[model samples]
Target: MRALPAALLLTAGGFTAAVAQQTAAPDTMVAKTISNYSAKYMDAECQLTKGHYKVSSGATYLSTAIERGSIPENRLRALASGRRVITEAIQQNGQDKNAAAWYYLGRIDLHLGDVAGADSAFKRAEALAPGCAQDIGKYRRVVYAPIANKAIDFTKANQNDSALVYYRRAAAWYPASPLAPYNLANIFATSKMDDSALVYYDATLKATMVDTAAATVKIRNQAGYNRAVLLTRKQRWPDAVAAFQQYLTWVPDDADAKKGLIQSLRAAGMADSASAMEKKLGVTAGNPMAPAAVTGATADYNAAVQAYNAKNFAAAAAAADKFLVVEPNNRDALYMRARSYVELKKGPEAAKAANALLAVDPMSETALSLLGAAYNLTRSSTQAVNTRLRLNALPFTISSVTAAPSGA
Candidate 1:
């Protein structure tokens, strides 16, 4: 190789030195800039900038740091700074194809308690980078946990309305988790909101179908059982029978489930099947409406009637339930129990009692009326309409006559 001229060699050396300086200056500036921000904030920015600039990571790290720091003021500042950095990145790069920017934006929104914003950002991120789904799911659970925990606390305190709000938020945040929906179903069931309860129970079942975890299985089983009970209460006998059978498959040894199955079978007009199950369970009679000699439970019957008359509906229902154990076919006791349940706004129990009465006396106008009221309370519009039609078809009787001529 030929030796270079002296001036050319010196010029080449100076050019190389200048190029190195240019590269080193940017690195030094990046390091100093990164040090001024949190590691969490810089991580994400660096990733977005392909390690050329320092910026924090997703909301997860900053949130973790905030929690560890245990200072409310620090949390506020860190979250604000993180949000500003992510927002600026999105604005500069545009969210059109920047998954990291969108993902970090979602994290910041989640930390800021802007659930809807976080949801939108996550969706955008998922659309931009399908590979980020696992990370998105991980962060989604982070948002879900505290909301669900708060809902649980509210439920325990009997603050159902507040519990409902947080539970709904949690469910929306993590739609694949059965926990929030299961708890929501339970709350609706306890409140006697059967239709709403059924919706959430179905959600719980759907979410748990592919999850084989023991806790999830338990939730599915309970949701199935409660759904069946609600169906039976709504007088959806066929659906109730199927739901009960399905639940029994999951918990074959549960006596209450067997009993529910028997009741549903009888209601669905599968008397022979119900009788066989009752015999197998060593039960006296699975159908409360079965024709039988009236048994003596005079004291309990009178107590139930007295409680009902006094407007102590819960006590009245309890007393009537006790009396019916001995005299299940007693029309008076059934009527009192059904009426008391109506007063207590327990649509399902009232419907069950009304149905038993109807089975014993199909032409019972009072039983028809009570069933209609129960269907109304349960929001079973179709059943309520049918009950009203049946009631309207009955021949006018002296007892049903409410008033004489106005002048008379």
Candidate 2:
């Protein structure tokens, strides 16, 4: 017969018998159902000594070694011996074996690359006594981190289905890992699966909020911004305004967000409210109603605006297009084109024009509102809902901001 590797032999039949004989279950060890196991067994006070079957302590020792690095040859053998004893004790003791045993069993299975078995065992442990393990955090690091990373990589490659599986698994295994929801939300958003994306985005925001670490804070901040933008695009004007306001709390001077807030307010049909916000933001004589215009395109801008106000959408769009040809950066012309598209119920065209306007002056409330309306008119209900929810969560108020210079 050929020699077998230690790992193989331990998992096979030979060592199991030897170890079972040495650590037989004690007569005093009363059997109890998994769901009714003694708390004493789960606590650290129950140390493993000679002739005692303490599964969790052994699991802790083995798992700690595995997390530190490769299990030494001696330690590997010891763990194998411990596993055999635990198996025998569970079989003989029946319902008497503590649920912590299953938790430990899961840890061992994970070490052996039997993820399915490990998951089953963990579930069993939880079924018997929910949250039986005293040191669950270590198990999460040993198991879930690699899985979450794989999900992230899959997302990066646009392998969304595979990423979804791993991300969900990672979340199942370690619910507190913000990366899981964040990555899942990102993939859904990219796929235009707005419903799922919004769910995960909300989850990510909630998880990140409780963490005060620098990295977590940064993630939370970005989550707030992204959520608010999504809300704005959904045309839930009131919600979008609220979200943008929330975002401003963290990033008070973000011009784009401020513009977004203003647009949301106006879209909500709160013109007086919008005007009040502009004042609080210190938009005064210096900062005119319109963004700075190219000197030569002033006449074209005035003509476009006049046509728009007159409800001559087609004529307004034409004039704006002509102005854009001369001064592509003219904010007023871009706004007119976008407004005309909206009035004409041309969702795609409106979105295009609004996007162009945003590119030139990203902090224009009017443009943000227009873009959001475009999403709604396009029949993207999920997208619209997500946008509204995200934007409504942001901070919109600001203090002590000088208006644009009195006259360009």
Candidate 3:
């Protein structure tokens, strides 16, 4: 997936070396520092292309270091040192004059799960000169494309083992791309390879942190939901509860997920809480909402879906919103609205819808889906994690917590 437009924020006319020279006196120290790191970066790229697995491994390690929650002391020190130097360069000489420094900082920020920082730095580098630091096209053509092709061909032949190897190769060569790990996780999950699926699922989430392109965001949404499913299957009650709750924020009306959440709550020794939730959700009721309201909401939802099916995302969002203004807690309308925002690439707007939906039903599947996408798009990993934690801590102690109406 390509980086977002922010990473290509340069104007029509790119900066030239001559222009840079004329801008101000060259800070020799900053230039030398950036040049040295640029050489190392290029060397790493070259080594990766030459089949040096270590280079790719280090890249993968760096990409996932922050996402994994804990880091070895030595690795932490190395990361801090690298970031320090890059910050120093930027402070001493503005990013515009030191394109390489910006480029390296982008790479570092991307690896550290700071997508916004990375995109800004990449934009600065590209603005300095088109060929400077953050060139994804060359990397795609030279590295990712070939291996991805091989992986696809192998998958077409039903050669899972061969496909897995190539997929791993692609992921290892460039950990920034979510395609490899996401697909790998899907394949493993489908094959009931739980352990393998978990590993790739983790990788998929981590990779998504670096690149939140539309395609990657979709994949990340799927991975996040499915990882929760896997956790439930493994009987990891606490984790499953958190995952299912998180998943619901994206897809509020997923009946299966709702049932799973209750099951997880019970299994985690919260049977009383689960029973209360079941009662609040009216799980045993034959029909909940008044028929008139249901019919109206359904009609509005269908109209929204029709627009969405026509790929008129803006229309779909508008229709959903029109319905939501009347039926604020209509699960399907909330989902359609949030999803349309996602398709429209309005990350902040999408997040607003998702957050609003969450306030009514914290476990809405559709809202949660868009929430993850929005957070990734805005590079708000900390916010996303904190949101999950807060949701996980929701009091479901028997009658202590009252569940929202299930669109009834």
Candidate 4:
């Protein structure tokens, strides 16, 4: 019933530096230890929106409202540094339902890998300004900005050279942004540039997932999940097992991690570990990678798209995780999860998606591209090249960027 702040209102100027140098708590947290002594996280959120979600000066004054409660220094540190979040806020001018706040603040929570925190922010918006959801439905912007849109288009064009040109162009344009390299890393992996993709994926991880100080356990879960998937695809079963094990430690409920662990163990010839995990998750009843029931969870899907577009891969992954909680068989959720892994620099996770993606749509360019990326990043350059070449040889016009004939 309580609300969390909807967004981070990092000012345009000094705030960038504030964010760049933001310090975090150093506690070794296995999971969250939320206490009610802190201000209640209100579920109220605004529906009317203007700009992207985040905090504003008026909401800053609400510091007094929060002052009434005693929050853990660590929690306070998390909030101040954008790791923790408030799901709702009351403005000084008494203006309620600040929809944008939820969107952007969710971004912060997403970046910090706070799935619970991010969800709370969106719930607050739902509670505060329910009308904004209607607008979101009406004028839904394309998730990827113009530059990313071009990259996707170019990749479809199969103009590797020209695609590279545009991809590099976007990367330079958003020099510090993660999505450019994230997308490029996928391509490099597809093109059998596994070593190169790994470099880029590592960079993508740093840009999108890694955090120092008091970061949440979720980021580690995400990064570890991704790494495990990539490693498994590259046939590095031991490392994949270790990575999956690390992911399970953070997200014990991840069916995929459980399945991946089993697969990794089997691949490593550690059949016993694989069997133990299989028995533990009880996948004995059905396929481990079965799609989840995500139909009614449209809100979560929209939120995931926003996070993905904002380049908040961890948050998007978290959103996908929540959706999967409801709908395991949702291919969209699986695809998104794999993408989240790639963006978060978890090659193994991406590989999981890549492999499964082929199952759903073998001819999917994006799926092929992602699989190629995963293979390349994990040191299977030959496989990556093979995948890309197969994609290029498709009957349809392959080069989205270059219109010339195959003979050309």
Model 4 scores worst on lDDT over the 10 consecutive residues at: 398-407
TM-score of each: 0.52, 0.49, 0.40, 0.33
**Candidate 1, superposed: residue stretches over 4 Å from native:** 1-94, 275-279, 282-408
Top candidate by TM-score: 1
Give the per-residue lDDT of model 1 (tens digit) for 268-308. Answer: 89988988887665555745333233234545666777787
lDDT of 4 by residue, 1-408 (tens): 112232433223322332343344321220121222223433213334433133553233233233433444544454544322223332322223455565545433433334334344445554556665543222112111444455656766766676665555455433334555656666776566666666655665565554442222322333455556678778888877877876667666565567788778877888666667666654442333332343345557666767776778899888877866665644566677777788777777788777865554343567777888887777787888898887764321111211111111
Cα-based lDDT at residue 380, candidate 2: 74
Off by over 4 Å in 3: 1-142, 284-408
Question: Which TM-score value belongs to model 2?
Answer: 0.49
**Model 4: runs farther than 4 Å from truth?**
1-150, 172-175, 210-227, 246-252, 269-272, 283-408
| Model 2 segments more than 4 A misplaced | 1-97, 116-134, 269-271, 280-408
Model 4's TM-score against the true structure: 0.33
TM-score of 3: 0.40
lDDT, residue 75, model 3:
44
- If the candidates were sorted by their lDDT against the true structure, best first, what order would they fall in? 1, 2, 3, 4
Error of 2 at 175 (Å): 2.3
lDDT for each residue of candidate 3 in 213-260, tens digit (9 for 90 to 100): 765665666677778888988999989889888777866756546667
lDDT comparing candidate 3 with the true structure: 0.59
Residue-level lDDT of model 2, residues 101-146, one tens digit each, is 6666655545444444455556666565654543545555556656
Instruction: Order the candidates by TM-score, highest first.
Output: 1, 2, 3, 4
